[model samples]
Target: MKEIVIGENQAGQRFDKYLSKYLNEAPKSFLYKMLRKKNITLNGKKATGSEKLKEQDIVRLFLSEETIDKFSQVKVERSHGKLSILYEDKHIAAVNKPSGMLSQKASGSDVSLVEYLTGYLLESGQMKEEDFRCFHPGICNRLDRNTSGIVIAGKTLAGLQEMNEAFKLRSLKKEYLALVEGVVSSGAYLKGYLHKDEKCNKVVVEKEPFEGSVPIETEYRPLAGNQRVTLLNIHLVTGRSHQIRSHLASIGHPVIGDGKYGSKKSNQLFCDSYGVKSQLLHAYRLTMPELKGELNYLSHKVLTAPIPSDMKRVLEGEHIEESIHE
Candidate 1:
């Protein structure tokens, strides 16, 4: 027999949902069965599946001790590698994932950021494979293959749910810095729908879709501009596949070194003259509400990845400053 008391954070959630976080080893069927048999009670009374819980509700469970022991034996195994940890708490970890690394395991790849992170947590002794039975860790959002910057992963199931909700509600904000060819109007807003061609691995911007296309909106402002290139700050109001790339290209200011949506001539010129390799884009900042009240105001973090060597060379040749901001 065990007693569980709900906290403020756990309030207003379903009973089965709450139990799932704590008794990770127990399947949903088992939980419902226990509830049917009166083995689970709230405030000393039997609970129904439809019962809405309030703050400070007390739940009690009657189960054999042996079952609990079996759950303790379950372990989660992981593999690790070089990763930069930007922020961490008991519930979540935020990292600055580098380019060329898959966020999760792809069809053919063996090593991924998730696998690396699991190994990191295990090696650091913050968690054991067995502990994972009670908590499933996973990345909440994704970045492109070559785009780099802050990526968040949940260390616990509760954290994952919370962060996922935050994203869905648009309570989380992300900002990016991109270098595009040609100059853009100051404080210009670009809006359009994007259709991705999987066969060609490119996104096409159109005012209307032929059949299967999604709506995407991207707002960009020219932070700095010169005769040849413009640096813009991009905010994605609606995240769709290749929204930024496709929208920017539609406006005739394709990003520098973007072979797919940009001019091949410009890409070759930059690569040959400056030795630049991937598109010049970086996730610059992220903001989210604090999980705990002690940190009251919205928590905002800024991340800066120095311009790649190839891009730096071009900027140096152009005599640009080390830092450029609006």
Candidate 2:
């Protein structure tokens, strides 16, 4: 028999959820069966899967050492690199994820931001390899492969939980800087419905309601403009898949350098002039709400990533603020 003591980071989750992290090889049905037979007990008593866990809670596993080891076997691989850090604390970190990089692994061979993050932690001695066996750190938020910007990561369980809740509750405001064809003279909030084609990995934004569509909102204000293109700051009201690109395109303002959902002539001209590759959209700003508990340091903090040089060169004559103080 073995007993595990819960820590602050492990608190507030269900007992079954916590156990699954350790006994990963065990099936959920078998785990439930074990719970019924008192093979797994919480604080010396049988616990239903719904029981909320707390700090200092003791979980006793009646299984032997060999059985536990067989079930909890995990393989960890080491990688090394420097990942740009926007903010970091004991509980969480905000990383500047670059375009062309996967936020998470696309496949077994893909090197992702999470790998770099793990490398940083290992090199900095923030975590050890064995810690991954029980509590693996993860990115709480994600960005598209071509969308460069800030991705909030959780270095601990409490941090991940709270950050995910913030995103789910829409407490965090995600903002972007986009260059599009035509001049946008003023700012306005747009509301519509969106439908996505998972097979094609594309989405359509409609002004009127559509079946199987979810509501979407977007607001944009022109920061600067020339005769052909305009730079705008985009506020994502409802962050659906490619909402900004599709919504903007549907309204005749497709983002510059976007091969998909954009004008071919505009793309060809910009590519020739600026060597534009992907869309000229950068996730530059993030507004965090009032935070509590372990992540109080991030309360009301506005995080911004510097615009890429390519974007700067595209709008060389336009006056734009590098950062948002508020």
Candidate 3:
């Protein structure tokens, strides 16, 4: 028999969901069997799988301890890849994930940024895959597979819950720098409806209403501009699939090297001349509330990754002038 005490982070989640974390190796049949046998109790009363847990709830399990031991003994492998750890503490860690790395494991591949971090934790004696119930390490927000930028991961379940809430409430702010073809007007607000086409693996931007289309708003400021290209500071008011790229393309200013929504001829010219493979978009800044209130005002962190060589070459070649706003 084992007693599991719920914390503030685990509260409000379904009983079955919570149990699934602890009983990692237990099959679905075994879980339902235990539930049917009334082997799981909450605060000394029989609990149902649908029951919602509350903070400080005492959950008692009559299942054999050997089951949990077997699950814990299973070792998950470490993924071989490069991950730059930006910031880390007992509760969470921030990483600068490079382009081409999947944020999490895909349908078949076990190697991903998250798996790599998990392996790092295990090697550091901080956690194991089975112990994820108590110390739930996970990525809070997602970035596109081809987009590179800062990624925040929670080291504990509480941290995950808090960060999730932060993102949900829009308390977290993310800023990006993009290099696009043609000169974009300063202080431009692009609003449109974005619809995803799974068949083509692309997103379509429509100025008018379309079936099953979601509204997307992107605010951009032209930081610098020249005859050929411009540097844009982008703010996402409404996050949608390929919102920035699609909207910019709709306005005839697709991001450089964005083959899906850009000028292929321009991309080819730039790639052939400068040798940059991916689009020129970088998440440069992130601001969020910290766990401690002392650093509340200073919670904003700016991350500046070097511009891809291809984009740099183009920008340097052009004689663009930076504009200062009054």
On lDDT, the leading prediction is: 2
lDDT of 1 by residue, 32-94 (tens): 888889888888887875676676888887877786565335555466576788777877788
Which 10-residue window in model 2 sums to the lowest lDDT? Answer: 317-326
Better of 1 and 2 by TM-score: 2
lDDT of 1: 0.72
Clash pairs (backbone) in predicted model 3: none
Q: Report the lDDT of model 2 for residue 249.
A: 96
Candidate 2 Cα deviation (angstroms), residue 104 = 2.7
Error of 3 at 319 (Å): 5.6
- Score each candidate by Cα lDDT: 0.72, 0.85, 0.74
Of the two candidates 2 and 3, the one with more favorable TM-score, higher being better, is: 2
- Cα error, residue 198 of model 2, in Å, equals 1.1
lDDT of 3 by residue, 240-281 (tens): 768888898999999988878899998997788777677877
Clashes of 2: 0
